[model samples]
Target: MNDPDGGTAAMALGAAESGALDRDAADPGHRDRFLIPPARGGRYSDSAYLAGNSLGLQPVATRNRLLEDLGEWARLGVEGHHDALRPWLPYHALLTEPAARLVGALPRETVVMNSLTVNLHLLMVSFYRPRGTRTRILIEDTAFPSDSYAVRSQAVFHGLDPDSTVLRARSADEVRDVLAARGENIALVLLGGVNYLTGELLDISAITAAGHAAGAVVGWDLAHAAGNVPLRLHDWEVDFAAWCSYKYLNAGPGAVAGAFVHERHLGGAGPPRLEGWWSTEEQTRFEMAPVSRPPASADAWQVSNPPILAMSPVLTSLRLFDDIGMDVLRARGMRLSGYLYELLEGIGADVLTPADPPRRGSQVSIRVGTGAAALCSRLSGEFGVVADAREPDVLRMAPTALYSTHHDCWRAAAALAALLPEVS
Candidate 1:
């Protein structure tokens, strides 16, 4: 249900056009850099694009790659698998370097594979070995439904009761308390690098240390954090992690996802992996022997072959990230988003995400009061500002760096201010 008062009816566009703050104007030429929907009908349509943190706009390069791949298919026939310029034989491997660079890890430590939820389960299968007293798994209470479901199912698969094995933390104090109280019994810690709904970036390094102190393996779900924030997964000593490329990475819908296993956790020197042909030894990969020799690295975790169509989009997207660069992109994101935060703060909207610039990533979540969902609906329906709403009170807005701009942020802030009077 929307707010009974409908606060944004007149104020939506009014607040957006109300003399945007000076900082909202990024440098002249670059100002229109990622203007995707290009200004249609006079005003601004990039404002309709604040939802990249949810699903990114399709890059023009992505479309071109798709066409190129389709052409290869039409001309090369069945032999295309080996005859094509980008051979399907080692397609997944091609993504290793760029993907590893994106998340800050050694190439062998990362592999573009399965969906986020599936990879989480596979990583758990290898890492979540429960011993006598150390059988619990620590997870966030507000984790995405997919993560929560995978954790619980893994617990059941281990012959442990989910009720007893699932330990949860809500607030910072609660998190500290759970780790202290049950640290000795935790077998694995599965946390999101950045939460899906709240957009809270977790301290993976600190949490990993705490979990390890208790003799537990620590893994993170970076579905929302992977491309949106700077991550040093290898440096942080993470045992394992997984993320979808569709969100911040802006791969197409349901695009191939990626996972990481610290170099220390690969092959015989590593934890027990659930294997498949893709992770088979390259030397004897086509020998079709009765016995299987696992790949030397994290590739050992794969249980099946990869889908090439799904990976092409990911390849194009990462190239763009490399071209634009994550460091430069992230810095602008913080500054531009910080301005958005002030604009919302100025209107008395309660910011739920951390205010500290370093702690937060690309997203800024807000609690716009009792009628938050309704106001959000109106923002999309009436104003064409494509932000998303979270349950009872929160609205999540992220100005992605690769495609989003300063003017987009200003427009969104102005839209919110316009709706203030109607709700109040």
Candidate 2:
């Protein structure tokens, strides 16, 4: 059998596996720090996990750190608020600095709070102001379903029909064009830093500047970008942003998410925000007055008390990112994903992600036409390659820098070749 690159398939595969092993030896990622799952079908003992973009593997330190917080609760009962090891009263404050460092924001501009979509809605309350002519929200055509739902609901909340209030652009060029031609009619521009299905990394700084030039508020949903790529939300002057901690941040499922509001909009005559008990200044929070005096910091966005238990994992993960840094992780991600892309091309797989390194994150998506779900099942059961499927046609595999290896990419590519022998 011959590969699409005009080589004997068996010989080419042997050399590819050898090359992958050598690369792994030269560049061993932080795989030892994570818990790689046991294989379900292949000869190898451990599964080659390529699904980190969906859910990251657990860090070895997560269990111990989480248990410590649990132990404090067990020991202190109601007094845990002030008496626990890490006091629950100001527990969320522990995450602020590291979370700020992760997204390149000042401590006052960042807050680790509510779930991703929930935080989006909260931020929109302050950022999305629909004036007389500027009444539509601009989003990507491939925006995540949750973001689509949130923005549409925001339109309805303002007594506007969603169909006319939400505008979907297919690319960054289209976004810029929309801002130029219909800037006065667009109230907000909300887009993903790294698109979920296609793995396209948008130019955050340029797009933000364009939106500002057009007099529209610009924001981002960094669910796939926060930890996968380096970001400078403050420097870019992004009006607002939100990200989940579960994916490349490795903070576990439904972990506490982070939000950022640029310094220009901090306080003193900024747009109005929905307020609650926690929204008030901590110094006077216990005064329990009828009116709330919100602080100037992003903490003013908080509407409820921090969930100590749920926040523990986020703290642990953010500290890891702070220590290793996104620059190092991003460089390693490019190397690994570039190798995977080469292998996929050799097998004649139809890749959906951009080939340019700067235009993408760690995720590599391919067009599987149909039966993507079943193909993913076969990859896992027959070869122990753990990749994910996006409904009918898209298959996404991420070679996360923190744990994935070149050999994992080789496993995924080889498995696909065996399953799809006629691809060439």
Top-lDDT candidate index:
2
Q: Candidate 1, TM-score vs. the true structure?
A: 0.91
Which whole-number lDDT from 0 to 100 does residue 349 have in model 1? Answer: 68
Residue 424 lDDT in candidate 2: 29
Per-residue C-alpha lDDT of model 2 across residues 160-211, encoded as one tens digit per residue: 9999999999998999999999998998999999999999999999999999
Q: Estimate each model's TM-score.
A: 0.91, 0.97
Candidate 2: regions farther than 4 A off: 1-11, 422-424
Give one digit per residue, the lDDT tens place, for model 1 in 1-424: 1333334433543555534434444332133434365433225454457777778777777777877778888889777788987878788888999999999999999999999888888888888999999999888998888888888898899898998899888955566678888888988889888877767788888888877877889999998888888889999999999999988888978888999999887656567777778778777889998677887677888888888778889999888777777788778788767877876776666688888887788898887656777987777666667787777778889888776656666666666766755665
* lDDT per model vs. reference: 0.78, 0.92
